[model samples]
Target chain A: MWRPLAEAARELIDLCVMSDVDEDEVRAARADVEAAVARLRKVRRTQTLGQQHLTGGRRRPWGNPVIGLRNPIAPPLQVSTDPSGRAATEFHCGPAYEGPPGLVHGGVVSLLLDQLLGHAVGAAGRPGMTGTLTIVYRQGTPLGDLRAEAWIDREDGIKTWAKARMIGPDGVTAEAEGVFILPRAIRERSPSSPTGHIG
Target chain B: MWRPLAEAARELIDLCVMSDVDEDEVRAARADVEAAVARLRKVRRTQTLGQQHLTGGRRRPWGNPVIGLRNPIAPPLQVSTDPSGRAATEFHCGPAYEGPPGLVHGGVVSLLLDQLLGHAVGAAGRPGMTGTLTIVYRQGTPLGDLRAEAWIDREDGIKTWAKARMIGPDGVTAEAEGVFILPRAIRERSPSSPTGHIG
Candidate 1:
């Protein structure tokens, strides 16, 4: 139900950033967008929490800004795990995700790596929250089709160390190392539990 | 002109996530949003790059995802420098920015810190691109009124090290340390030049 709306909203965002419309046209578009907002606000979700679990056993958060299906801000990356136990995704960004000139936002890259690392750790049968994330940008991530991959580096007690990298047309652009830790609550309750609060 | 559209887009996003509208209502809203996108796409910007400098000498990027007035994905943070040369902003995140149940997304925190560190380094008369960023999540950042601050820790040749933190109601939820470096192109041109590409 929401996938179409989110897709349309993403289109609207890209147009908003990359278009050269005049103020008169801008006003017209704004009016239409406002009408949509008004109509949607007629009903509010009293229970927005725990809605992700209700999505038929899927772990995807529909409103995540990086990979949420219902989120317009996300490139809505479709990540898949290889047989070798590595998570990977190939995605594209338009002008809406621009940081400098013609380049993807550095923070956007961080957001992608964070999500990819989370997926890698979760694929390892140990879901955890992000404790420490370190990113090294080797070159500017251009705004276009890009590839990213992540794998578990090691595990230390309650912590899981992971590594990931973003590849642009020019090979490696950025690399990340993260330490994800099981929340104390989940660890205290059941150390072997795969379900826990994750970022 | 894009401000109103971006603002309305943000409102629509919040409503999309936090609302309980039915399929019929969702369809109605989707149509309106599609109309807006169609209208806005009638014209395309021939030159989208380097448009930031056209904004009346202001350093702000109108389409920036973290603090862009024309970017809806941003909480659209307005950062200010204090008398002590620290960068700070007080902002709020709605349901659109949620990650873990009721807390702000961890990557969203990283985005804010990245932009704050950029502002801090720029404020110190040393504009550069992000080299490395490290974030430590001490606690979950809540989804409401929050505060963040950044300052230059030191400068080593063409590299500037900075520190920042996000403060929720419970105290500091996350701390970030970033290393910003003058790009090789800019460094070769003039090591003392303040005008250069930044993250």
Candidate 2:
């Protein structure tokens, strides 16, 4: 995937050199690359398979909540939602993901926290932004098979308190706590995404 | 800097193809690449200068801390100890770091947060592993002249709290909050890094 981008960059550099552009042009080219990448920030929400993870949950589920991945494609390892408060995604990590020997990169784990906690804020039936997120990595996590979950703990007007985690093959590997902020832009419902008790 | 590593990888693959060592050597060469990467991670820690930042008051610092990059050879950043219960850094986000039009990538913002916050934990004069760090993108951040600061917010025996931020040309572009766990190595010094007073 990065190969095509590298090829494009090389071509752009070639074009810059051929045209004898100034340093300002080089700076402009860098902006062009980032502008191109910014487009990927938008996330596409999938139709709910109608499948649900929470089913009359006083019983509670297995493992710890602090460290887990929700959907595999959930890059940003985080979550995204419309106004309904339901978030979705899929993600994967490979060799580049490793941190300490067999351990996954700690920074990547935080990346997931930002992604999922942001989702939880949206799940609280509000379209908002992230105010804060805190995570705890309890132990080394081996690669592969991650689970994620998020829910609102509290909400006050624009502030939504939420939590999420990535449970690895070794069980609860890391967890997070956050405050999601619903900015004024779309704080109210879209009429399309109705409110509900969220996870 | 990456040229030598790339060349070494190419040479190893070529050598295995030309010699009669067997297919196992190809596997060995791949392992070599992995080992090389591990070495890079080990050396990665030696890069920081000032360790982290602090507020000393109950109030969260009104704005993001502007950290200074003290080490000339630091890899875009470095961490060093500050006796007042704080840590700081200075780094340059070059062409390799862009995620938005003329701005640094969001992930990079979080990366700086993790590093600064770790130093914040270190500021307590105790070395604990990270449990969580949450980042909020307040506004778009440009790629150059980035400053970061981190400091202890509150602390108990096993749990410590801290906050961080990435400041750039535009202003305070990001804010972060973290919870860190003291590994026994540093937890033992808990008596020194109290919540109300700066170290």
RMSD of 2: 15.6
Q: How many residue pairs clash in model 1? A: 0
What is the lDDT of every predicted structure here? 0.83, 0.47
Model 1, span A37-145: residue lDDT tens: 9889998887553345434454558877777788888888998974334799999988878887778888888888988898888777656879999999999998889
Q: By DockQ thresholds, what CAPRI class is model 2? A: incorrect
Per-model TM-score of chain A alone? 0.90, 0.52
**Per-prediction interface RMSD in Å:** 1.6, 17.2
Worst 10 residues of 2 chain A by lDDT: A59-68
Best by lDDT: 1
